[model samples]
Target: MIDVHMDPQVLAGLQEVMEGEYPRLLDTFLHDSEERVKALRTARGDTQALRQIAHSFKGSSGNLGAVRLALLCQRLEMASAGDIGGLVDQIDREFAVVRAMYEGELRRVFVG
Candidate 1:
């Protein structure tokens, strides 16, 4: 798993655009994440839907500075073209990380 760093440089760039809008952005990410997860779950027998949902997830994560998650999603998206049975656990784990990160960031911005 790639270490998704919320380094100064990365956060600086995200902060530049996010600014006081972090909460909204975080909400968007959360909504998108949930939607993607649901799509992925229901897409078990549909390879195309799986690929598309993964791709969409990758885009959303990238937009939120989640490079690692985006990469994982991209990998899953590509792997969906083949057999996805073996990748389920890994994908679920990564998705958990992404969800936690998003939630944590949101909490920091809103509660701190």
Candidate 2:
């Protein structure tokens, strides 16, 4: 089965490379993602701002192997107006799923 929410291989590589800092990376990613989503809400109606935010968010999401979220962000970046609000909502929804997965992983890592 292909998991569109994330790429486990990229995450595994991150774990191998980050060692003790992996957890911290996850924490930071969640926090930053929240902020980005907030920015998206405020940047509505400003197409350029939306594109820039989506571009930056896409890079971070891609770096973290958030495959689906990154693709949504890419779509936002390329969006020339039209249903910006709906796209932002979609991105937010995808982030929620990704956030849940990361939070679950964190709990297991810390609790087990």
Candidate 3:
């Protein structure tokens, strides 16, 4: 409902993509988001893989309309050089909220 990161064009594109296999899109988002979160959980913020993970999540989430989570991912990416332990928990929580909301809406639109 809140198209924070997704503009009308993006939403339209998403709708077109989901015209047939909507469940697949939802599954992909869930799986990829989980992987990104797991990467953040284990990342020590010094490795290039960690930075890549954050950047990937930021771009992916933004494309999927999870603006807040994408922003957090950007922050994590930017702050990857520092001790991100404390921010990890916060990011996880926020990501979860966005994930849930996005899933709920996705279901409503696609599965309803």
The clash count of every prediction, one per candidate, is 0, 0, 0
Model 1 ranges off by over 4 Å: 5-8, 80-82
lDDT (Cα, tens digit) per residue for candidate 3, span 1-112: 2335434466558868878675577668878888888888887645577668878888888887777677777777777455466556766887778777667767777666
Model 1, span 1-112: residue lDDT tens? 6786333366557767778986787787778787777777778778877888888888877777777777877877888345675554566667777777767877777787
Q: What is the lDDT for 47 in model 2?
A: 95
User: What C-alpha RMSD separates each model from the true structure?
Assistant: 2.3, 2.0, 3.5
User: 31 in model 2: Cα distance from truth in Å?
Assistant: 0.2
Instruction: Please give the distance, in angstroms, between residue 16's alpha carbon in candidate 2 and its true position after superposition.
Output: 0.5
Worst 10 residues of 3 by lDDT: 1-10
Best by lDDT: 2
TM, every model: 0.81, 0.93, 0.77
Ranking by TM-score: 2, 1, 3
Model 1, residue 46: what's the lDDT?
A: 84
- Measured with C-alpha atoms, the lDDT of residue 62 in candidate 2 is 97
On lDDT, the stronger of 1 and 2 is 2
Please give the TM-score that candidate 3 achieves against the real structure.
0.77
Any idea what lDDT model 3 has?
0.72
lDDT of each: 0.72, 0.90, 0.72
The residue pairs in collision within model 3 are: none
